[model samples]
Target chain A: MAQKTYAGVTVELTDEGYLVDKNQWNKEMAVEIAQENDITLTAKHFAVIEFLRDKVEKGETLTIRAIGKSGIVDIKGFYELFPGAPLKVATKISGLSKPVSCV
Target chain B: MTEKEEYPLKKVCIICAKGNLEDVYAACVMANGAVMEGIETKVFFTFFGLDAITKKQMNHLHTATVGNPAMRMPNGWAFPSVLGMLPGVEAGVSSIMKKQMEALDIPTIPEFLEMITAGGGELYACKLATDMFKLKKEDLSDEVKDIITVGEFYGLCGGQGTQIIFT
Candidate 1:
């Protein structure tokens, strides 16, 4: 039961720093989280985020290889964008839950 | 709140020492889950676990039907050991498992490794194990980041709050 404040908004977070309530997420929060992770948000990053959100909304599993095959970015490109643990970092900034299929 | 309050774990190192389909997937699943939780994750494959990373055996991994007390049939009953001894039973069981995984949309072994690696997880092959098995770097799947010694593997886990998982 921890909280993170961003751009005048505060939200609850899990111990892992994931937003506790998806509804509490906003674009600014995404930006803030990305900055905290040493990532600068770009259209390409947003594209991956949007793809993640869309997939989550539709109840589809997300996998790195799936993203690699999606043509938005290849596996190597994903690493370049997120830099570290791409799926975890991307999902965090996307304001989405951690993907269960990541493993 | 403190940083530790926000993120309890710093890292996780998962070791895959067995090669059977069940054991290898168990390690893969756990390693992937750790990274999904935002934990820095590294997986070290050693011994028979090399089979999982080896190009020729990765996709064709077979389930260990013999002496597997936890295995169950389609009816939720204990799998018959006698049936396991019959010809083609191993392949039959392995195919069934593959089919079930496919039905669930789970990726194959190589794809799974690709997904894990692309997600920022690290994959390493054991130097001793590779040598023992006579596997060259070219024989492994592309997902393997490097062949590292056991000492080097431990060095990667040298971080505060890092957990080591062996399967």
Candidate 2:
């Protein structure tokens, strides 16, 4: 396991930098993680993150198509919110494991 | 030994030459996958592959039930070639195939094109094939950026870490 400190809080992470313990994640760390990817999180981004966390908690699969249908954002808006591999970047900062979806 | 620097794929140029349901889906999946990975993606459709973007045909694609070596009955038995020749068998089997993919969260061909382009992937039709079939731009899905020549398509594939895939 890898470790990093964001906002004075050290947390376990995967080698790829996703949080190993979702509970260890906080809003401040989310902002720091987004910064690592050069993104500035906004209310819209947080809403998507909340949706992803809920979806994962329910033991559902993560897919771009599902997320597009999330009603929080359309496919294009989702891409714009988290550019450059939206799913990967979104999940990483959302305290979720890296998504294993192709579409 | 020192750790090697990672060199990720920077771009993908996919070419689809067939129009079968599986063929078109394969191209769509790969192109969309590349786009989701943040790689620059360009899809070129030629010959029957144009059916994937053709407005009247894109969503109505069918996989081959006859002469498909991997085909099997739902019970896991080898599909009989004779049964495949019956009317509606191909269509029935193709819909089943589509359902299977759908259950895996794969999008329909039209929706896949929308997702790909929404992520900044570019789609094009081959000029030679479009002309041979007498197809015009309006015949293709609105998601298609243009009908381009092979030379022009090749020009877009230029860049380091770019792969040209023919499926």
Best by TM-score: 2
In the order shown, the candidates' Cα RMSDs to the true structure are 3.9, 1.0
Docking class of 1: acceptable
Residue-wise C-alpha lDDT for candidate 2, range B1-167, written one tens digit per residue: 99999878999999999999989989999999999999999999999999999999987899888898899998999998999999999999898888999899989999999999999999999999999999999999999999999999999999888899999
Residue A82 local lDDT, model 1: 90
DockQ of each: 0.38, 0.91
- For model 1 the TM-score comes to 0.78
Residue A79 in candidate 2, Cα distance off native in Å: 1.2
How good is the docking of model 1, as DockQ?
A: 0.38
Off by over 4 Å in 1: A1-38, A83-85, A97-102, B1-7
Tens digit per residue, CA lDDT, model 2, A1-103: 9788987899999999899988888899999999999999999999999999999999998999998998999999999999999999999999889898777
Q: What share of the true interface contacts does candidate 2 keep?
A: 0.91
Q: Candidate 1: which pairs clash?
A: A15-B6, A86-B119, A103-B32
Q: How does each model score on TM-score?
A: 0.78, 0.98
